[model samples]
Target chain A: MRMTDRPSNEEGALAPWFAAGREAAPLPSGEFMARMEALALESQPAPRAAPAAPARQSRGPGRLLARLRAMGGWPALAGLTAACAMGLWIGAAAPEAAVDWVATATQEQGLSGLDPASGFDYAMLGL
Target chain B: MPYDAMTDTSDEQLLAAYAAGAPGAARALTARLGPLAFGHAFRMLRDRAEAEDVAQEALLRLWRAAPGWREGEAKVSTWLYKVVSNLCIDRMRRRRGGFAALEDVAEPADPAPSAAARLQERSRAEALEGALAALPDRQKQAVVLRHLEGLTNPEIAAIMDIGVRAVESLTARGRKALEGLLAPRRADLGYEDD
Candidate 1:
């Protein structure tokens, strides 16, 4: 019979050879293990250097004042005030605020002479 | 397995302890992974002398990597496997023609019928080793791991850093190629004895 006709397990004559190969195989032991461990340890990346500590400057009234000014100078105060005003304008222009303001304005001044409510809201007309 | 000096805690655990400055953990890990690692190196290197050197270098790498080995990331075996495979690949490239895979290089052909058959068989097997050595790097590795070392596809894949499907393909191809290579000599290997 052709070798292909024999199933792998039925290749009985070859079994002993296979078994011998398996049996004679070496096990992981002794000097071999030590050598592998050494190789493994060698492959590790080197440790990083510790970061340098930040330089310390003397702290007193002068330094404190300087830090405060850096944080909140006149330009910063002006920018903050402008930001707050813009926030107020944005808040007033919100749908809810717009609705309220329009209602109050319409009540105070009839539809003829009206303060333009930020933008038109047809929801006020129940549309 | 009995948790003896031979085989105890896992390599990962030992590495963790070693990272934490447990002085003995390195030796423990060395004992555990040593044989398989050396065998792997030997298989690729095909030279006992070079295999031994590579194995030593590989373990030294493990020792160096130990201190910074982050906890709970990758298994120690997985890490070692990749390192060893890469090292073997590099060594194989650097010294391509240095070693032959088989221990028994050229057994004498027997003069007597009974003695001759045995000697011829040994020589045939040794010659097959040269053919096995001639297989491509990945195919050789797959064959060695799957058949000789008895590693499963997943283990081989993890060591190879490839998908399981790829490992299967490599092993299947390797086996089929080996069978083809060895088929004509089947009777000589005593396959037809029965």
Candidate 2:
């Protein structure tokens, strides 16, 4: 249909008709507004308190330990310490076993062994 | 600032105030958005209770999102219109029966005049609404947002998530369909008198 056939103003040919509709169908009742306000208030977040002053700033190992504690507390720190100790022991005691395991796994997958200097043999893999 | 000062605040600022737990911000936001949402939903669904539910849910979502409401991202009214439109469309999809006929739909009482002219005006509005209800969902939405809600084509496009060209096409087709539907009642609607 041609746009020119309709009223050329803001609401087309039915602007006055719609205006009457709007007047007849006004906004929701006061009860609806009350319910909405209640719902909105119910969902509104609680106000945040202002930040408190810090006691002291940590430095060096103290800061590192604080960071670890903040991450997951004593258990996490202990776990990290245990992991580092295990790594040291494995490197010192069973380096050959680790290398053999890597080489065997890669060979089984039809891949080359690791280069000690640069990790994987990307050249052999045609990279 | 005091909570009463929020009456003149922008929607974004009012939302921020609401997130900050200001005293009157919730009421302010509700008062501002409730009518617009309800009116749009009512126009779409033509059921007062269902439209009320849709409006409440839409505002509830806005309240939930207020904490993370980023300023300057979009106009708050635009966002609410998008939400209301989606909810209305979903309700329309789940509708099992045909559109409500004019007599079946509840009419809000006209308090203006007790004369025949008032009756005719009421019928004209109802007829337009019925014609609107008979339209396909997208076309109905496009026409409602364009004509009744007085939104620009670009704003309708953003709300409907379609291109401006698509909005234009939907509204054009919707207007044509509406004209055809209302043609039979043109005299009753007093178009002949015009």
DockQ of each: 0.12, 0.27
Model 2 misses residue A4 by how many Å? 13
Candidate 1 CA-lDDT value:
0.63
Tens-place lDDT per residue, model 2, A14-106, is 566666565556479899889988998899888766698886765787888878778898898889899999999999999999998988987
The TM-scores of all predictions, comma-separated, are 0.55, 0.69
- Candidate 2 achieves a global lDDT of 0.81
Return the TM-score for candidate 2, rounded to 2 decimals. Answer: 0.69
**Per-residue lDDT of B1-194 in model 2, one digit per residue for the tens?**
65545566888888888999877888888888999999999999888899999999899899888988888999999999999999999999899366555445445355356677777777777878888888889999998887778788888899999998899899889888877777777776687897
Q: Point out the worst 10-residue segment of candidate 1 chain B by lDDT.
A: B103-112
Model 2 interface CAPRI class: acceptable
In candidate 1, what are the lDDT values of residues A1-127, reduced to their tens digit?
2443222333243344444444444455556555555544454334444598887767786687686699787688789889999989878767797778888888877773374542345557665
**Residue pairs clashing, model 2:** none
**Cα error of candidate 2 at position A125, Å:** 99
Highest DockQ against the true fold, candidate: 2
